[model samples]
Target chain A: MANKLFDIIKSDLAELETALHESVVSPVATITEIGNHLIKAGGKRLRPAMFFLAARCSENFDLKRVMPLAVALELIHMASLVHDDVLDSAATRRGEATANAKWGNQLAILAGDYLFAKAFVLVTENGYGERVNNQLSRLLADLSAGELIQNKEIYKASCDTEEYYERIAMKTANFLAISCQLGAHVMGLPEKDVQALYDYGYSVGMAFQLTDDLLDLTGDSKTIGKPAGNDILQGIITLPAIRALETSPDKDELLSIVTNRDMTKEDLNRALEIVRATDGIDFTKNKVEEYLDRARNVLPESIPEDVRAAYMMAADFIAGREF
Target chain B: MANKLFDIIKSDLAELETALHESVVSPVATITEIGNHLIKAGGKRLRPAMFFLAARCSENFDLKRVMPLAVALELIHMASLVHDDVLDSAATRRGEATANAKWGNQLAILAGDYLFAKAFVLVTENGYGERVNNQLSRLLADLSAGELIQNKEIYKASCDTEEYYERIAMKTANFLAISCQLGAHVMGLPEKDVQALYDYGYSVGMAFQLTDDLLDLTGDSKTIGKPAGNDILQGIITLPAIRALETSPDKDELLSIVTNRDMTKEDLNRALEIVRATDGIDFTKNKVEEYLDRARNVLPESIPEDVRAAYMMAADFIAGREF
Candidate 1:
């Protein structure tokens, strides 16, 4: 099913890849180098895919017009990640050295900023006016706020589930929702269709994050491209761990292990064990499935059958994928 | 002369102050706190002043329409400064504790991103579309590139004079030039007037930075709001030091002292003395006057006499201001 969608959009995706590289080209050598490094250590391009898919759902979809918005969406995601890596003091991302690790925190900060500015330039140059600007700027703000909130909650034993949800909603769901909405918006689609796409993206985005956090503990470094328990090790308290903290019989021991700044390999393994021993992992998986169901239900009936089918397959792929 | 310009723009400046405070208001507590702190630290507001002055030069100066742009210009300046504080690991700015000093580098980084986002939001919300976005985004890219080049040159003995000019051009001159250009552009001024303001701004901005670098060596800490010789101590090779490196008989000695990361207070004093003994300070002062002259020469003849007089005073004031 995923392959069907991939095949349909294969050409668009290829063009996006080239645009992504071309967008970051700069007179500053360091910006281009660092930007190229990040583009090379690629993600799933989920935001751009969401955008392209949403755009395709409309009769007004002009590939030339939509291309800049698509590029901006993914660049925004990449810019946020580059900044996140600095905040995380992360040495590697996607099995490659991070910009910060390669060029130091200072240059990495500038590189992220350069990417952000380039994103804005591309959209503005293409004349995606106030709507795109307002949405993208607000998304950037919310993303930063998510990082701040996550930073504030790091290693706090009493980190609330509500807070965790809010953080993920800001960091992931709204970003994807906007990607979908903006695509529909730029196509001059009906407001109803745009809203529906936003809803679909929001649900899928929430599920995507939940699945991601779950995999951080359940998957191996070889598959995930980072060590297992990586997020928790960095003091991030995600849903499964929060659920474990609430429901585990060894709750106090688990809390102690997670909260310890000096938490070790043994401690992480044990914490993972304690979390797995609870219904935390099950609760998280169930939550993912529930969100994915919501996503499937929210699809606009006005979209063509093939696009609808592709979206359905995309959601299912998200639900079942190991990485 | 500065007071005359200030008096003319007093009400607009006050409104801008209120709007600036209002813009950074965020759901995230850290953003507001850091933003307010930076605002209260009290910069000269030169960028916004330049913007307002340029607006007033035109017949179409509508305060209501221009307010957002004014606020955005200053916010962008503040945003760049905040990020620069992180890069420099600065303890204080404008005689107050820096965001990074009070919070941490991580929070400071987020705070800077928040401010940058808020700047874009303001302009976009007010419906300043592609023209504003294109200019502002390019300015941002240039600013980050300036920081990158400056960072790359730190402690490098072979840093070129041409590179120093390019760095400062990117950092300060281009920012000021844009402030003037955007003001005229938004006011629907003729292209000739816009070009004139941009040229005027570019010249003054170059002089402003040269004077600033000069003050780093020649002014007292109390007046300058930072320790004398702070730039050199941080491995920044500015105009005066670059001049001294080329012309001073003690060139080799000064080069060694500036290049040594571990250089102490006595070393800085000695380097300052060597620079002073040469004609470096005199040479920089001459350059400042030359640029200020060019600034005065380029003022549009079509502006009101009062507006032209105010700009003339602005140039002289920038040439002579102690801080």
Candidate 2:
């Protein structure tokens, strides 16, 4: 079923890749170099794919009109990652040197700014209505605000599960929700249908982030691209860490290890062991399942079966991916 | 004359200050803190002022409709400053500690992003037309690319005088030009009048930057709020320095001092003295007068005399300011 869905959107994805390349071309060579570096070190292109799929569910989707928007969404995602690397002082992304690592932070900063401005340029030139443009701006606000909150919460052992969920919802889920909503919006779908699609995307996004948090603890370094357990090392307290702090008998020691800025290899290993010993991993997995279920349940009965099936497979992919 | 123009726009400037404060309020307290820090530091508010003045030049100008856009233009300027501080590792701006210096770089980056997003929110919510929004985005692209080019040209003795003008046009003049263009556009002015306003704004903007470059070389630290001659210390090759390099008998020595990056105060003083001895300051001043003359020449005779006088006063202010 996943393969079948991929078959349907394969050419659209190819065109999107081309559009992405063309969008980042700049007169400045460093801007081009840094932008192309990140673009070549790719992600799933999940947001744009979801946009295309949601448009497919509509009765009168226009590929040409929607293409620029799809590219814009991906560019926003890529721009954030470039900035995120600088903020995290991350040396590697997708097992490749980050733009900041290759170029200095100065050029990286400008490149990120360039990509962001370029994304808006695409949206404005393509004539997405005021509503979509406004929504995109609001989405950026939420994303940045969420990151600010996360930065404040770093290494604080007192962070709660609710705070964790809210942060992820802002940082990750909102973009997905808006992506699906925009897809439906471009199709001129009814407001009710658009709302349903947004809800579906939100739930799927939540599940995807929860799964990502779980992977940070349990996944292999080679597969995850960067080092595993890097989040805790960087003082990013994910759900698994939060749950372990709540339920583990070794809570104090684990907290000490996670909160310390200079945790060694042994300390990280012990922290992971404590999380594994507790119900943290299972608790997170169960939460992902719950969200995925909610996502599937929210779909309108009016959607075509094939379209519905593709969405379900997407949810499954999010729930089941190892890297 | 400048004071009279300020008197006419006093209430509008007050409203703009309030709007600027309101636009950056975020859900996160830190984001608000950092944003308010920059806003309260008080730039000249030149972009927004130009926007308002250009709008006033129109016959059917609507204050209520143009206010949001004026605010948006100012927000974009403030946002760029926040990021620019990060790139330059600037400790102070407008005589206050910079956002990056006050908060860490991570939060500063997010704050800048928040302001950029909020600027768009204003434009989007106010229902600015596609042309305005597209132009704003393109302006951002130019701004970033110009900064990138400037970054590349730093410390390079071969950079020509024409290149210096082009760089500043991208970095400063274009934003001012667009601010004016947007003002006329909101008034529903004819295209010819809009073009004239843009040209006027561009020339005035060029003069404004030229004066700034001259001030960096000659102004006192007490007035400029940053140490004089700091640009050359940081390897920024401004117009006066370029002119001095072209005409000074001590060209090789000045080049060595500018490119060294670790020049002592004695070396800096020697370089400044050499530039003062050459035609650089006078040459730059003549260029400013030339641009200001061009700006005055381009004004349509159809414009009201009061409006033309205010714009001419603006040009004089840019050319004559000490800091």
Candidate 3:
């Protein structure tokens, strides 16, 4: 099913890749070098794909008008990742040295800003007017606010499930939701359909983030492109960790290790054991299923059947992917 | 005359202040705290003032419509300064602890991003359309590119005058020029007048930056709100130092001091003395005068005479200010 969806949007995805590459070209050689590095780095391009599918579902789908916005959405995602790597002090992403690790934080920060500017330039050049710009700007704000909230919550073992949901909603879900909303909007979809796409995107995005957190514990470093247990090591309390904190018998040891400024290898190994022993992973998987169900349920009957099927398949992939 | 210009824009400036303060308010407490810290630190509000004056210079002056863009412009300037303080590792700015110095690099980076996002929100909320957003986004790209170029050129003793101009043009002048351009644009000015305002702004912005570079060597730490000779200490080759390297008998000494990663107080003092002793300050002063003259010459005859007078006075102040 996922393969079918990929095949459907394959050409649009290729066009998006070209647009993304062309957007990052700059007069500054170093900027071009760093930007191209990020572009060439592999991403699933899920956001752009979702955007394209949503547009195709609309009554007035025009590839020419919607392509730039689709590309802009992907660029925003990339820009956030670049800055996130800086904030996380991440050494590698997708098995490649991060821009921050290679060129230093100064250059990385500027590169992120450069990508963001280019995104806006694309929006403006393509005549996506005030409403779209406003939506994109708000997404930027939500992304930053989510990061700020996550930064403040680091290592706080007492952080609840609700807070975890809020953080991921702002950090991950909002952008995805807006991407779908924008795709529908640009194609002149009715308000009801736009809202439905937004809901669909939101539910799927939540499942995507929950699965990502689970992968941080269960996935392999090579397959996932970074070390397993990275979020726990960094003291970030994701959904699984929070669930484990609530249910694990060795809650004290788990909290201590997770909250420690520097955890030894033994501590990390033991914390992983504690989390795995609990229902944390199972609980997270169940939550993903719930959100995926909601995503499937939100498909408006008005959407084309094939588009709905593709979106459902995309949600399934997001919920079930191992890496 | 500068005071007269300020007097004219006094109420609007106050309103802009309120708007800026309100714009940074967030649901997140830390973001609000850090944002207010920047707002209360006291800047001359030069960008907002210039924007207001430019709008008033237009035939269809309407404060209701233009005030938001003016505030947005100032926010962009403030956002850049916040990030710049991080890159410069600046401890103090505007006679207060910088956001980076107070909150650490992590929060400071987030704060800078928060401001940029809020600036966009303002643009969107105020219905500044695609053209304005495009220009603003391009200006952002220019700012980042300029910073990258400056970072690359640090401590290169052989850096030439043309390179220095190019860097400042991107880093500083473009923002100011765009502020004027946006103001004229919002007021429904013709292309010719809008171009005139942009030219006027570009020339004045160049003079503004040159004066600021001069102040780094010559101004008092207490008055300028940062340490004197900071550019040299940081290995930033500003205009005066570039000229000094070219014309001073102590060229090698100046070059060595400027290029040193760590310069002691005595080294800084000696570099300052060398720059002062040479024709560097005089050369920079002449350059400021040249730009200021160009600014004055570009004012459209269609602009209200009083508005032109005020803009000319503002240029004079920029070129002649001590700090």
| Top candidate, metric DockQ | 2
> Which candidate should be chosen as best, given lDDT against the real structure?
1
B1-323 per-residue lDDT for model 3 (tens digits): 22656676778888887887888888899898988888899788888887888888766788889877887788788888888888888888877899889988877887777778788888888876778888888898898889988877677664688988999999878778888888888888889988999998899999999999999888986668777998887778988888889888999998898888888999999999999998889999999999999999998889887778788889878976887
Off by over 4 Å in 3: A1-5, B1-5, B58-60
Q: Which ten residues in a row have the lowest lDDT in candidate 3 chain A?
A: A1-10
lDDT of 1 at A211: 93
Off by over 4 Å in 1: A1-5, B1-5
**Model 3 steric clash pairs:** none
**Ordered list by DockQ, greatest first:** 2, 1, 3
lDDT of 2 by residue, A1-323 (tens): 22555666777888888888888787777777777788888888889988888888877868898999999899989988888999999888888899889987877777788888898999988888999989898888888889889887788765588888889999989999999999988988788888999999999999998988889999987777666887888889998889889888999999999889889999999998998899889989999999999999998788767778888889988888898
DockQ score for model 2: 0.78
Structural similarity to truth (TM-score) of each candidate: 0.96, 0.96, 0.95
DockQ of each: 0.77, 0.78, 0.75
CAPRI rating of model 2: medium
Better of 2 and 3 by DockQ: 2
- Which digits, one per residue and each the tens of the lDDT, describe model 3 over residues A1-323? 22656776788888887877787777788988887898888688888888888899876778889988987888888988998899889988887899999999888888888788788888988887789999998898888888888887677775588888988999888888988899888898889999999999999999999999999999877778777888888779887788888878898889989999789888888998999999999999999999999999998899888788789889878877888
The CAPRI quality class of candidate 3 comes to medium
Q: What is the lDDT of candidate 3?
A: 0.85
Could you give candidate 1's per-residue lDDT for residues A103-177 as a string of tens digits? 999888987887787788888888876888889988988888888888877788655888888899999999989
lDDT of 2 at B242: 90
